[model samples]
Target chain A: MLLDLLNKLVSARYPLRPPGAVKEDAFLQKCIRCRRCEEACPYDSIKMAHGDWGLKMGTPFIYPTAVPCYLCSDWPCINACPTGALEAVGEKENVKMGEAAIDETTCFAYNGIICRACYERCPIYTVAITLKEELYPVVHKEHCVGCGICEQVCPTDPKSIVVFSAHR
Target chain B: MTRFELHFYKHLNRYRRLIQILSVLFIFIVPLLNKAGMHAIIGTFYSVSIGQLDIVDPALVLQNLLLTKEIHFPLLLAGIIPLVITLFFGKVFCSWICPFNLLAEFADKLRKKIRPKTIRAKNQNAKPQYYWLVFGSIISVAAVSGIPVITLTSMPGLISGQVADLIFYGAVGMELSIVLLILLLEVFFWPRFWCKYACPVGAVLALLRGKNTLAIQYDAHICANNCPVNLKKVSLCNAACPLQLNPRQKGIYPYCYNCGACIEACFNKGGKSIWFTFHPQETKTNKSGS
Candidate 1:
């Protein structure tokens, strides 16, 4: 009786499961621990970290708190994903939460070549880009807000930087 | 006691499998729609014994969706229905429902085409070393990564995705080539070998199979003596289980999923009332007759 009452109360309080909020532990348990998703992430924000949940080792993660989600129009991660672990499509609002990354070696600004086009063209340039006095501009990852503007503007043969979103 | 109650029970008995199948269809089919708009309707959390948790807890497939969020009633049921079926029968889901199982079977044909003639490794005593290797390193890695890396990088998934991508991109000319490669790899070698050895999902399921509330039972007279796994006479029950578990085992583990593959197998063998019990030890029935 008590359990029943408690169940009822819990349901009333937290009725909504915020679609796609299902725990993926069971599926993660089935995962073979490959790095395909990591390579597929346009943001390059995915990393393999096995901690706390010893059972969920070598899985993909995007620490959005460390970075920010930059919505990629064409998600390579979805295209590249093989297992159902990563759904081909997902929520747009949630997808916007994935973080982005930049490789300084490929950034035109790193070569003492002034390429602030990414910063100027970025939708969130103010939050996603920062100017460094060293050579051209140094991107502060903390404040850089991985929007992929740098990646898109990057004149390198093939864009050498990317970002990622938390694929929860 | 009442006629209405008896009638209801009869109907229930007949439609029970139908209900289960419908539930599974509802589960997988609905979530598929979530992909169309990338607007999921389902939430992540579900109520478990240990309070509330993510519906796709473990995030293997949902994480792959990569949409903002999704509503997937079909997916939830599709996933949970297998467990439900196991609780009542014996890993029937593996034989009938699993898309992966179907894929593996499809690949089996292709694998056979190019499969190298092999020296059947003497069927030796299997060891627990593979289990340790599985849980110790691979599982730990998945836990840390918050995703199942095992199947993602799998050659099969990669190959399939490549073929699908080629088709999706309208590279019509490339489709035949990719299909041929996939078919050759899948049919020529071994049928469902990936599930037996490579599939962690299979591993998890095998562990849970014996615990099934419903499962297969042994009949001594069928083979006139030898066990089903003796792999000689063809029997439906033995052939049904995706794991290829011997239906004639003593006191099967309690984790078995009640897929009725064995029952169907027995039916083909001219067995009777094979599916007599809904749960373990509920009824003592000799379907093959005295």
Candidate 2:
């Protein structure tokens, strides 16, 4: 059946999230199944899969060969995910691949101490985290990898720098 | 002339319930809740080249956004009410209003057919680890685009008769196994889990939901003696939230969508303290849950 071919094509390229992740099947069912993921994909790899198998419901999948995973921060695709189907998670790289949170209180903005520890230390070297005229450190989530590095280096006790992981 | 009714206002819960009722109306009462307000505009502009419709979504808006330079007025309102509701009510919409939410719960109905006993929600606040792949990819793309591209990917199209379209056009001899699998997952795993965590709109709303908006209130005295944390997290209502809100929080958790199922569930438990605030007289004394 064509469904068989479709499944094989997808499986060969990308693997599904590990088992035990049907966080909300009911929620996924109602999704209108638009291809928002395609637009958000920095790599232009995501495609609206053939609905023949009905596997391509509301969630969008990546077809690596066409584009491959271009790991942009914030994963606008995750942010665009209307259902939990495209769940969010923080990577270990501590490289922010998404928006970073700034605790205004402890943020260097209020810390009275000048430091762009995150901006300077970022591994991607794009200055994803920026200092707002010596104000609080604003995170360009697009560059953040959810690696908790900013959070780790935050001098504030409350930890002004933090990433909202699994937030996509 | 009349004195302000603010004195009598439960303040928070009033707007909370109003948000809930409004979301319900948006979802259920609307002609096509999923595709409401999307067709006429996007149809003329996008003209999806699908079946007979020949509608192309991106083309319609992209052309408009680029050429006309005038904002597609409707696009401004796209997911506005729902998004605003999430900011105010902590995603109560997921539980009460969204038809998909209702269907998600109904899918669980299949569960009842299988087992008379209900499987309770446990560990409601477990940090989602799987999101790494999901959020990771999305963030990667956003970084490159410098725009919220997910807007185009997620958030189902709200075209009219979309359900029928899925049946006739979408379901045409499609894999029954995938459909059944999604159904099985909905019935067994987190019922409305997708709406709870993965919804990009919901996430955006939550980011801005830290305020005095209307939200579920778990009064310490009442919740300690009568909270429903047993079913899941800190409270019964919290556990039921498709968005996984912490009912015990003093103010809105930003993710709360104001869905009233939690209110209904709490009412079922015979808790009088749980009140839906809507100014004054409108406060419905729960005949039954929280």
Candidate 3:
């Protein structure tokens, strides 16, 4: 019965939940659908998913293009959660919401252009992203928290550096 | 037989509307405070915790119970405040506090005044929507597996929170549409449809009220004979009720929000027939003394 619900939730195009969201299955069960996280989000990064489907209703999620998590030091979204759907992580680097991957086809830095926008805007610049000697941007997946700031600041029309949600 | 105290009824009526307006105003103010970095002073639609004390919606508590399959003691205790209040007072939240009800009431009046010909849906024998409780719990179990379902339909929280987000951020996301649709539908289809038949929160509150201990008691003698002038005129108490419930009927006690509107109407019309009181025995003596 539970697996049936899980399959239904995953079948849809799932957006990334907040930074400290628990594993998807646990998050589904624990979230009371109170939407306090949406209220607490400072940047208005969190928006409740709206669909008529009974399974996807009133859940908090984020679309990077609209607003990306600012990664506040206090982590208000997690603190505001009454249920432990979102848990506090020991370090911001450990708050693994997703992974950022660079699309070589669209990346200006990769196309021999002098663009280091992603690296420059990276919240965890030195650790998660770095610039090579030729000024090419490289994303270190291991250290990336995937807060999506780099994606938001990407100069490409559609971001060359996109954060793939770890949730799915 | 009893006489309604006009002054006391007037005072209660004034405060009831005052509380309702304040609660609705605070709905907008809370999100702004949240934006200003005040973490301690926020409560969601499901639960409201101020400082240390918490008061949760009992319907949501039931959902948690279905999902977790065990009692979360802190949440249970948090829910007790509203439950205990409901047990004693009977559905006061619907009339005097819930922001959605206040808006719906205003919408109802506007519809009546602006488009008097609009045919409002009427369910004369409306019963508490128990199916919502069953469906809500089933959704909670599914949510436990994957999917947060109830927040989509929790009108009070969704509307107020979305309104707050709109004011603070100047962004109206798709979530606001559901609430807007309900309000728009209300202008034509049903006046107070959600609260009257479908609100799970109202259903839970009605269930929590074990007996009609604190409710409006009708004095038939006074209503029929004490004030001939009131009887000659149209029934103000009946017309004043936003829910369109008859306060003069003992059967309607469970649905009465103790909003004091009927009491005010009765007092104003020199009827003094319908009065809200706790002890039936005490009100008789108290009314005679007054």
True contacts kept of each: 0.09, 0.04, 0.46
- Residues B76-189 of candidate 3 have per-residue lDDT tens digits of 887889888888888898888888888888888877987888533222323334434555564655455533344446777777766665776686657767776777788777
By TM-score, the best candidate is: 3
Clash count for candidate 1 is: 127
State the weakest 10-residue window (summed lDDT) of model 3 chain A. Answer: A49-58
Task: Give the lDDT of residue B131 in candidate 1.
Answer: 44
Q: Is the docking of candidate 1 incorrect, acceptable, medium or high quality?
A: incorrect
Pick the lDDT winner: 3
- For all candidates in order, the CA lDDT equals 0.41, 0.43, 0.71
Over A39-137, each residue of candidate 1 has an lDDT whose tens digit, in order, gives: 344444554433222333335555433332354656544433333444544533332332345567777777567677656655555555556663454
Q: Better model by lDDT, 1 or 3?
A: 3
Arrange candidates, best lDDT first: 3, 2, 1
DockQ of 3: 0.39
Least lDDT summed over 10 consecutive residues: which range in candidate 2 chain A?
A: A14-23
Please, what are the lDDT tens digits per residue for candidate 2 over residues B1-290?
12243222324344544554564443233223213422221111112121122222331233224322345344333435444555455545444434445555567667656664654443234444443345455545544433333333333333222332342235322323333455567677655555555554345444444445565555545655665445333356655544444454442333446655455555556543454443212222232322
TM-score of chain A, predicted model 1, versus the true chain A, to 2 decimals: 0.40
Q: Residue A88: error of model 2 in Å? A: 37
Q: Quick one: best DockQ, which candidate?
A: 3
Task: Write the residue-wise lDDT of candidate 1 on B41-140 in tens digits.
Answer: 3211110111112122222343333221344443354345445445455544444444445555546534434564531222121244554456445555
Report the lDDT tens digits of candidate 2 across residue range A111-153.
5777776666555455567666755566776665544445556
| TM-score computed on alpha carbons, candidate 3 | 0.80
